[model samples]
Target: IRVTVTAIPIPMACSPAFEGKSIRKEEMYAEFGGGRSPAFELLRVRPEAEVEDGKVTVIGPEIETIPEGSAAPLGIVIEVAGKTMKKEYEPVLERRIHNFVNYGEGSWHVAQRDLIWVRLSKEAVKNGVRVEHIGKLLASKFRIDFPDLLDAVQVTLITDPEQVLTAKKEAEAIYDERDARIKGMKDDDADTFYSCTLCQTFAPDHVCVITPERPGLCGAISWLDGKIAYEISPAGANQPVQKGGLISAENGEFEGVNRFVRKASHGAIERCQLYNFMEYPMTACGCFEVIALVLPEVNGIMVVNREYKGETPSGMSFSTLAGTIGGGVQTPGFAGISKSYILSDRFLQAEGGIDRLVWMPSVLKEELASRLKERLKAQGKGDLFEKIADERNAETIEALTEFLAGVDHPALTMDSIL
Candidate 1:
């Protein structure tokens, strides 16, 4: 139940008890990212010459100088050096920043990669927890959590508006490179899948089933990344799960996967359907990314990404849904997923694939347009693209049904959802 029980020199206590805690807008001293400003974090393997153990560098004004309750840009770059460190481990280690930051009694972090949203509490600021303390906290935990793989870990925190903007672009390139390393792979094409239990720091029984089509719900570790992580540290969180007999091809249940889930969840969970959201869906750790839930009013489903601050047809904001869905529990009618999973051929396979997709935020809709267009064309449902709605079209259950009917949306005519 304890994560990094070692002493960390910070104003507030550091423990797993605070891992998924939230800080409200009124309770926040300062906020960053979350669509308000550019923010990103990256971890890189560096030569010993480039790393200074325990160094925490804060660029721009410290957190104390920032105006209360204002959002700011942020960029965190961690340079690590060790005899065993490899580039393949960058994402695996970088994601720990989310865990370490949330460990702060007064700090809250969500999502991962460029879509991060972080908040420092008024109480923490009053207790002298500054921006530099965040770097110190991360530096200590990185070494503590991966002692065998990291010898030295130094951190750089950039908060200047323009600098953060520039640094985010640089970090994005690195993300693209990592994503490219495992392109054009398929789940069934291989004999085995991968697992990620790193988030077990907070959601102990949750195990991320990483396949080529479905990345971790946090949107950080892909199937290829999981494989590389296991190779780097065979005893680590990522492990290979051989694809045994198919229990249900429609719902994406494998004999080997069910066995692994039972063992990993300590017998707490016995069934997990990877491709179905309304029946035994995988447990959600609720770190970041997107959430899909059925809106039975119109016989369809809607997806809301972390950046979407407004309420969805499901009558909940992204944060509210995250709180309700996580804690290693399987909610049959909902699932936490990466943005890329929406484009996968297996998305909601048992409930009728992407055809059940009725609404999403416009920004996300546009973000996946080209690739989604190709997917729709391949599925012979290219016209369904225009039929899909967004917030501008409808934000409530009644409005969504009206809009779907007005547009003759396929979901309205499809099979029952519930």
Candidate 2:
């Protein structure tokens, strides 16, 4: 017997607030990922001959078959082929899937890369929407958004438990390889960086110049992402910023960046030091993954991510701290950065590097454990991770200072950050 659910027309314009809106457990018809089961989204550049234009395949159960209030494993693999398509563009396109999927009238999507959570509304199912509709939505949206760079697009949706697990593993490997390739790339290695004005809709003066070492504050766009974005739409938000001259190698100040920031911010920001938080740090647009604040009492910096709702050593919650630093203001001693940048060799090089990090939320520390360990080993401070304190160890400034003293944290012996 054929079953038909009602279908609602996709919205032409999606509200920005809808992107962050979450679906509670009680409200969702079906949930995916969110640490419940294996799930991932992968995008790949394929040879022209290997792709069938506009084809979307569903390997397992369709949306209507999923039990209400059930959590299911999900794997989304998108393949695109075009003369101009490059491997560097895969992640950029993959990231767009989140936004495109959210454009659906009754669907909600959050997060990106391997950590994704999605919910299909019962209203959508009642409208006769199926899993294949998501594939079509993505394929159509990509063509509309990147017409010049994509000649064909195909999407594969997997829900079978065994298949989801296998695809997730493969996606993880691909993700690691892509990350390694991007990590090997350095800012100075390129003659041009890219500017992202995507957040300008919310903060008009904010302009983010993304580099290999410094990804966007939102933790979404990388250097390669910016590059492809410029290639596809030269006049778009992502524009190429020629690296004209170097002002300070130690602090990562550049003549081109200074000029770009002044023009982009309409003269509100006169100067910016890319790798330093103590000087004229880059202005934040409010979507930053983490905020690094100077903790003068401990002579170090405490990192707080958006997910941390508790009080920080700075005696401020993440929201309160973000308000003080964000909105296109050149707030000295406060820098907004991507989580991956925390692992880079260029992470706050002028501000004493990782040695200056004193405290972070336990979840943030655990998330970066492997990377932090590797970076520490490279710096010949493999034991420093142990020396750093988390929320569990210190919640107040005094408590953090005492904890650092007890641990003999190197920041205590370093030059005063104040």
lDDT by residue (1-418, candidate 1, tens digit) is 4555558988888987788678988899999898898899999999999999999998898986898988888888999999978888899888889889988988888789999888999999999999898899999999888898899999999999989888888898898788767667888897789988888877889988889988888889999888888887799889998879999889999999989888988888898888887888899987748999988888999999988899898999888998899988888898999988888888989998888899999989998899899989988988988889999999988899899999898787788988
Model 2 segments more than 4 A misplaced: 1-39, 48-50, 58-73, 105-110, 117-131, 159-165, 201-204, 218-220, 245-248, 266-268, 285-287, 304-333, 361-367, 395-399
Q: Give candidate 2's whole-model lDDT.
A: 0.81
Q: List, residue by residue over 175-268, the lDDT tens digit for candidate 2.
A: 7776677778888889898888876644668888889998888777888889887786778888888778899998988999989988988888
lDDT of 2 at 251: 90
Q: Return the top candidate by lDDT.
A: 1
lDDT per model vs. reference? 0.88, 0.81
Estimate TM-scores for all models.
0.91, 0.79
Q: Pick the candidate with the highest TM-score.
A: 1
RMSD per candidate (Å) reads 2.4, 5.5
Please provide the root mean square deviation of candidate 1 (C-alpha atoms, Å).
2.4
